[model samples]
Target: MDTLTSTSANTWPIISNIIGWTYFLSWSCSFYPQTILNFKRKSVQGLSIDFLYYNVFGFLCYSIFNLAFFFSEDVQDEYRRRHQDSDNLVRANDVLFAVHAFLISFLTLSQTFIFKSDQKLSVTAKTFLLTFIVFILTAIGAVFTEYIKWIDVLYFLSYIKLLISFIKYIPQLWMNYRRKSTIGWSIHNILLDLSGGILSVAQLVLDAAISGDWSGITGDPVKFGLGFVAIVFDLLFMSQHYIFYRERYDFYLAVDDSERQALLPTEQS
Candidate 1:
């Protein structure tokens, strides 16, 4: 019985590590599909500039969160003390993924400037930027005055990352609805993103099971919520792609057929 139990315990961490790496890969590559699609199309017509705006800033926050968490000895010690399972703790991959995400987002933003597209910054984008600026200034002031501890600042950054993750899709969702098409967007990216989200959540679950610690399941609530919400939004985008946007393309094909037929008759006459 001891041998069996030991074997089971040993296997779970290996499985968890596999899932974690898979999640990392999925997320790391998720942006490429959209970036490639944009380059191929040479237009951001159906894409939302506001979406890019929020994404860039969101990733910036995420990068900061990862950096602060990785560097702060206090945070690291607390995490170790709380979890008591060092194997399942945050690794270099987490920081690497954050860095990769930020770079990809910046590249996507560059696309907006390089490519000619009808998409423009919406009122919502402006509002978000302004609000984010104010929040950053306030946080800086608080930090300078020592009104909030560095650990608390780390928590605040984590919250910002969570907020950004939760709402980042709104601009694109709204834009797709307004345009009634997903022409300029890449469904492939959403598919990859959904895959990453599921894998990330699975990693968390596996860690919980392996360590036999569930108290902290929600301890990093924002990280957990980010994965879950990303999955939700990815599905939403997929539905939009198949149900709504597909019909639009079909209608466009029909119109083209009719116009071609009309021209043929005129040419025959």
Candidate 2:
């Protein structure tokens, strides 16, 4: 059965590769909407500062994890030894996506300094920032002391990324609620994020199904959980933009005198 499943999984590489790259494109493209929006408006006024910081940091850790796992044979061998797996689950597209995401997230963070914006990271975000720094340092110390392998550090970093991704949306959601607007925060970003997230989860499930190894999904749920959390948050963001705060967003960005007048009177009240 294992041999049969392995052969089946080998045959599925082409299809899985296609789906993997599709999600990569979806996720990589998702970053551009907000980047372009910031440039177009010449401001990051309505964008959440905390979101940018958390996103960049999360992707930084994720990039390290993915790149190490993909390129470091040591990590791969350790992974297989740890999991007793024959196939290497790390894909080139995964590494590319993570690196690209980190670069893009960093680019957005740069805009916060370059663009017109008075917003600063909130107290909660600051705490998280410090925690991430300490976590990385501690992991490095463990690696130096030979208490943990580099592969173990990479695994820890990946898990940290998952946690960061899961919580990163909260500040943005709260910011939008407080401001009652999603102006500088592009709705297109949310839509693309939702698509990417859904596709990511689909890819994982497809890979697991083909390999007949439910272990990755059942045993290692970080990636799956992050994807699921992103989808949920994206829906909430959609609601904020299209339902809950729609009128406020429209009114806030309504520059034309006629357009401003066309907004619901309740917005003015």
Candidate 3:
């Protein structure tokens, strides 16, 4: 059972912190444009409710996972015991990013309630949410019944978040396709998210370089996969905004220019 040579905390502490916080800010900032857009339109029209539901729930799980792994000695010990004493990869920025992302996602959900919009959680979203509820409850039962450790509960929570990451973006992409426009949705959000995803993957590479082992990535391929998925979706969104739906977007602003005026913020390609 080959694994990372040494994982008792990161060796490159300062450099790791810098990379961690940079991506933290980038990923945390990714929610702003959508928030601002919702305010500008006084609507969450093009924003998908399914996306928000998934986003909010996913981040909540992620937040718990990060917080527990980073802050809980019991969880940390259990994790190490399970993983042959491998240090948990969670960093301060990981906890901060997860908490901040959850807050932002929750704020966006609140906006959906305040604004004028007809979108409701899809049956699919509801089903997934309910399914996660069952998953979470079962994890709790396992923990209390001594079937699994608290750290295992944390991992299960993260797994739900991971599953949601793969599913969350689809609604937004489909909405853009159906409307043939990316107007109400902000492209800036995608750009910032793309930067975060790229940086996240880069950070993994940097860690591997310093450690002289790629096992950090290979060991938990889900982390790498999540970054890759985000990057792929961000690129697809870039295409939808800049190429596929440019005409529709331009026409939207052209028609609404009189009303939207300066309220509709513009972004660069």
Candidate 4:
């Protein structure tokens, strides 16, 4: 079998690995700030629930899909193992799936509660009803396992949700770009996003070089185009915040000290 390779073949993997690691670390490091903000604010006041809701749903879908894919891979691995086929590939896939799935699942699930806490009663009521319906549908599909391919439905929903998320972010990106500021943006997230963007483009380029087409990197140019633009502007936004609007980034620290100070009433007294 011949694989058309890129000069970036070895480099791309290292880059991709680095990108993934940075993403994971960024999110992990950011958790404390976001958690403290929500805790002290007692609200998700300035956050966009639309972003959180779609992401949470998407992560839930991805987690479920990961389990399904892992099971399938395990079955294939078991058969191959008996036949003395290479176990290395299977092991690699298992580790990859476990890491990606667990990180996404944990982040989404944890953030969901934080956002939920901040939602208004009316908003919360609506979200709960919608989530309940999705759960019920998913449960019914689980019950009729063979006939109902609930995972597929969830995957489709996730796809749609990501589409909607991009759409939502588009206007925000444009508005921010035009204004040349990221007034209310999260610097940590923007920084992570900027890095993710470059890595994503590299991944796409590498994939295209390998396959001689843009098949696996992303679905199509339209989707890829949207992602590209979003990422580019996100980098710009992050740069603006880092260079010009450093004060807002302190929103994270302020939340932390406020919480700390609250806990020690005698210190003020």
RMSD of 1: 5.6
- Residue pairs that clash (backbone atoms under 3 angstroms), model 2: none
**Residue-level lDDT tens digits of model 2 in 60-83:** 888888788778888778877877
lDDT of model 4, residue 169 = 52
- TM-scores for candidates 1 onward, in order: 0.84, 0.87, 0.86, 0.51
lDDT (10s digit) by residue, model 1, range 154-220: 6677787788787778888987787667767888899889998998888877676666666455556
- How many pairs in model 3 have backbone atoms within 3 A of each other, for residues 3 or more apart or on separate chains, i.e. clashes? 0
lDDT of each model, Cα atoms only? 0.75, 0.80, 0.79, 0.47
Give the better candidate number (1 or 4) by lDDT: 1
* Backbone atom clashes (below 3 Å) for every candidate: 0, 0, 0, 0
lDDT string for model 3 (12-119, tens) is 556666877898889989999999878876778778999998999998988898888789998888766766666667678778888899899999989987985788
Off by over 4 Å in 2: 1-11, 218-220, 248-269
Candidate 1: minimum summed lDDT over ten consecutive residues — where?
Answer: 247-256
Whole-model lDDT for model 2 versus the true structure? 0.80
- Candidate 3: which pairs clash? none
